[model samples]
Structures are given as structure tokens and as C-alpha cells.
Target: MRPEIIRLLNENQEFRLFVRQNPQWYRKLSRDPSALQSLEKEANYFYGRTFPQRVERMQSNLGLAMMMMEMLKMGQDTVAQTQETFSS
Candidate 1:
């Protein structure tokens, strides 16, 4: 491994983790340090570690949760209305 690549692996936890998970990158990077860019892009895409991807995932989860809450509230309201009708 090149000195710069060694230093990068030591300094960047994310890159280190990525390389650990995908050992092929180690040989690729050792042969051509310039491949680091493509490796990072692939890692980001594979892990959904990019900011926009993370934000989109969070938004989708929030929307799902909100819809669930709305459904629960509507269910409760229906039960209450049914009870009121029976009591009358």
C-alpha cells in the first residue's frame, strides 16, 4: 500500500470501514490510488451514506409514521362515535 493510502485508511474511519467490508478495494487502491474516488462513490451509494440519500430516507420514514398516527387517531374517533351512539 502507498504511504498516502495508508495514511488515508488510518485517518478516515468511514473509508476504513468500507475497505474492511469490501477487501477488493484494498488491492484496487494499492494498484491505483486514483481509484479512491470511484471507491468512495461506490461505497456511498451502496451504504446510502450520502446526505441527500439519508435525508430522503428520513423523510419517507417520517411520512409513514405520520400516516400511522393519523390512522390510529381516526380509529379512536370511530370507536368513540360508536360508543356514543350505543349509549344514546
Candidate 2:
């Protein structure tokens, strides 16, 4: 993944969700369970320490930023279109 994408996910809704969803393949107790157990323990600690509400806050901020970014892009596109029409 792109670094910026990873950064957004890390700062926003991704790491927690990735940790939450990482262990789906470990559905059964087995002889080689140490890795899975370690991951679970780490995830548990991470989740325990994280304020889940921050995820919601980050999402809201991201949404607002995206809206503004989109508006700016549209504004630029509109300017380009107006310039083209005037040139023609």
C-alpha cells in the first residue's frame, strides 16, 4: 500500500480494524498456536489502551477534510473549464 494510504489508515480507521480482523484464519487450537496467541495478546493490549472513540473522531475529521479537498478540486476544474471556453 502507498505510504500516504497507510498513514491515513493508521491515523484513522485502519490499524485497529486490521488488528481486529487479523486472526480470522486462526479458527482452531493447534500445535503451532504460539504466533496466534502472541498476536492476540498484542492486539488485546493495543485495543485496551486505545480510545475507540478516537476512531469516530478521526473519521469525522477525515470526512470534513475530504469534503474540502473535493470542493477545492472542483473549483480548480471549473476554472480550467471556464478558461478553455473563453479561449475557444
All candidates: TM-score: 0.77, 0.42
Residue 29 lDDT in model 2? 20
Local distance difference test, each candidate: 0.93, 0.60
- Overall local distance difference test of candidate 1: 0.93
By summed lDDT, which 10 consecutive residues of candidate 1 come out lowest?
38-47
Choose the strongest candidate by lDDT. Answer: 1
- Show how many residue pairs clash in every candidate, following the order shown: 0, 0
Runs off by more than 4 Å, candidate 2: 1-50
Task: Return model 2's CA RMSD, one decimal.
Answer: 14.4
Candidate No. with top TM-score: 1
Candidate 1 residues 35-82, lDDT tens each? 989988988888898999999999999999999999999999999999
TM-score of 2: 0.42
